[model samples]
Target: MIEPSDGAPPDSGMTLVEVLVAMGLFGVLASILLGLGLSTQAVTEDTRDRTGVNEEARIAMERIAREVRQSAGLDSVTLPGTPAGHTSTSFTFWTDFNNDGARTNTASDPEVMTYEWDPDTEELSMTAVTGLATVTRPVLAATVTSFVVEPRSSRWQYDQVGGACSCADGITTWRELDNSAVGNYNSEPDPQELRFADLLFVSMTVEDGNGTQTYSTQIDLRNRS
Candidate 1:
């Protein structure tokens, strides 16, 4: 028997339900791909943030160390200790941090380089003083979280009073020594003069919030100067 070809075409396509199901499948696949892309982006950003923080810390530490190592004159050096009979943390001295041969006050002329923190931005910055006077200009990276500077001196009692003893280039060990009878560098102070005794310890921490990533570096200032 010859089957009559139906004028109506045979069911040439999927049913409504089948079509809907296929669309749903495509949607699911697209969503999965999108999610993967987003994940990759997040990971990349995190890595970049971490790397940037670490690099910033290293640069800051190195710069500080270099300046300290080049510190000019005995009086130019100051430690984070009490001066003579004064027991105050506000005690600071002058140093030619830029190797300009003249001592400049922290706030005055013959300016050098200094690292200062910004309270509003929670950042640490380096500024170079221009001209013969104390003019300042920015240099290097910013966005630092915590910057702490600790200076160790020759005399434990008067670390600020007597200048860093045994101040020499290439000396690596530092010790805390006792004060002299007449307030001078004794032949053998308790803390042997090395990098650390006269050294300024600069510690900095930088971070990015999203990943809670942090970078930190500890540098001895005496070695760099």
Candidate 2:
């Protein structure tokens, strides 16, 4: 006769310890995947922030250059330099704002523009004055950390513009952003003239949560005599 049958059939399922180990391993894998996903998302956000800051800075610089170039007379300009005579956070000028070959800035129609930087608020703004009405608008708020305007006289050699100049359009290359008037188009002494300078060395730095970018341009003022 065969031996007596075992009390229970052979065990087919895992033991308690094995089940617990498997559960722990699965938990570890899930945690690792979650961590990697979060890391990737953070990197993407940072890159976007940096790109936005750079683009914003570039736009601000171009705006200033465009307006200054159209100006016919500079009332006053403040740049950063020795003796404290050339250093200031604001510049004022009267744009040529000609109405299609017509004259502008008469006794009752004079228009003045000013660009001012506030260090405490980290803001840059533009102010326009027409006769007695004055309006101030924000240009680049909370992005521009520094705005320095350096005034230079005409006629520097091409080879010396880069090395001797404190700024350039981009990457410190010496380039005339725009051609000037054919000749001394306005030879008369303009009441708005300041130091009779024609070139503006603009340097600005912008920063955000991501990073900072600095841009510089040599803007050739219009209506130079």
Candidate 3:
């Protein structure tokens, strides 16, 4: 090393105070980045959960609609015992899977289909009859909170000259069927009138870790009209 000239200052590195300040600033920046990352992760997880619930609800509704559309007529609908009586939990109908356009019931062939909602299990199940054997399958697994099926009738009276005639028009209007109305129809004197409903309204509610979603659909019976 060479000797310094008179009144010249010595060169040196950063002091301890400067190093401490720099380290503190770096730590603060790191913490801010970490917080932002955590928040983004949380938001993504919530969106995923919500999307799952919606997808499940859509699939379930589609399955029910497809089966209902193939129904020949409504067999029966059962509601839970409640004062309000706002929900129906089970439904049975005749489905023409073979496209025969008619209901069939023989020792070797059966066409009854039933949809049941089990509150205890939070599941929706379907039962089909083939000949003398009955097979039951779970349509939707747990997480289903409610399943309701409502049937409505549409009757028309044709204008006959100057008087009204008993002829159903091709157009049909749908409405929610109540328990009392269902019971009255079931007690009809004619067995042919037991399956009188022309349209069905299917609704369901699903709940998951994210949230709850409700879906509704309308199905028209092809063979009924």
Candidate 2 per-residue C-alpha lDDT over 41-135 given as tens digits, one digit per residue, 9 for 90 to 100: 99888778877777777787888788788877567654343214433477887666654443343545545778888766778888877555677
Clashing pairs in 3: none
Please report, in order, the local distance difference test score of every candidate based on alpha carbons: 0.48, 0.64, 0.66
lDDT of 3: 0.66
C-alpha root-mean-square deviation, each candidate = 8.4, 7.9, 7.1
TM-score of each: 0.57, 0.67, 0.67
- The candidate, 1 or 3, that scores higher on TM-score is 3
Q: Which regions in candidate 2 have their CA more than 4 angstroms from the true location?
A: 1-11, 79-88, 100-111, 155-193
- Please provide, for model 3 over 1-225, each residue's C-alpha lDDT reduced to its tens digit, 9 standing for 90 to 100: 775788577778899999999999999999999999999998988888868778867987887778777776777666565224434377787777777876666545567878888877888888777666787888765388888766655532211212243464443322212222333323221224335566677888888565677888878776664
Candidate 3 similarity to native, TM-score = 0.67
- Candidate 1 backbone clash number: 9
- Worst 10-residue lDDT window for candidate 2 reads 171-180
Q: Which candidate, 1 or 2, has the higher lDDT?
A: 2
Tell me how far candidate 2 lies from the true structure as C-alpha RMSD in angstroms: 7.9
